[model samples]
Target: MYIPQLSNQKAFDSFILIDGVLHFFQFTIGSKHAINRGLVGVGEKYGFPKDMAKWHFTFVMPPNRVLKVPQAHQGPLKDSKLYSAILDVGVEIPVE
Candidate 1:
């Protein structure tokens, strides 16, 4: 299901129920550039049921940088620490 461009102009993706668990995958929605707040907004609007334990949500992390740099310029684009952590561990861990 999807929410129209209501007052917020943000789009909600889908909600699926499997094995009694409500799963929601949401993308950009609010000022936070994440879905955490968006989930809460929709939840309140829907008057979600009491099966809190059966609810699951995954939010997308927004990109932090976008720029045009010279070809010779090369001074630590993004954060090396974050890149290192991802390599050390794995993508399974949420970067956000």
Candidate 2:
């Protein structure tokens, strides 16, 4: 389930939550146009005492040009070469 794109429904939706149900996330709520945003962080962690399915979460944001920070691990190579290796390997990965 998604956070519904808000139009004039903010008042009613204000207290709604992702609830950590299905072990999902807690995200900052905001307007659809990216104005008047608010910070909402929940540190509650969910564990799989029995069912392991809750540990996975997949999110797909709308497409846009992305500028990303260097990854936590740069691997065993220099930036240019490593970037090329990653790109070559990633090229054939399917999106869907």
Candidate 3:
């Protein structure tokens, strides 16, 4: 899986899967104050609640066959950028 990353970014650097939706957090200078606030749970590791609106992409359930997101703790979709990216990847539907 070739996930896009910024300069020297790791797999789980600036992103988190909250409730099955993968969110990309693009932090800016103005966001410094908000980032300072305490982030609770796994969502904080990626800087949520503040940068929640800056999410880059969102894929609906069944993100693709190659990757499986455990359906455990999920939240509401706040915002999104490109749906085309999700379609271009061709996610596989799981078998029931």
Candidate number with greatest lDDT? 1
TM-score of each model, paired residue for residue: 0.35, 0.19, 0.25
Q: Ten consecutive residues with minimal summed lDDT in candidate 1? A: 77-86
Cα lDDT of candidate 2 equals 0.25
In candidate 2, list every pair of residues with a backbone clash. none
Q: What local distance difference test score does each model get?
A: 0.41, 0.25, 0.36
Better of 1 and 3 by TM-score: 1
Which is superior by TM-score, 2 or 3?
3
Q: Model 3, 44: alpha-carbon shift in Å?
A: 1.5
- Ordered from best to worst TM-score, the candidate numbers read 1, 3, 2
lDDT of 1 by residue, 38-93 (tens): 44456657765334545555444344422221221233212111110011222243
lDDT of 3 by residue, 1-96 (tens): 224456754222255556645564432212111121122344566445544444444223333323332221334333334331223335454444
- Could you give candidate 2's per-residue lDDT for residues 1-96 as a string of tens digits? 435377454312222223432323222222122211111112133132223222222222223222232321332211111011011322232333
Q: After superposing candidate 2, which stretches have Cα over 4 Å from the reference?
A: 1-49, 65-96
Candidate 3 accuracy as lDDT: 0.36
Descending-lDDT candidate ranking: 1, 3, 2
Candidate 2, residue 84: the lDDT equals: 10
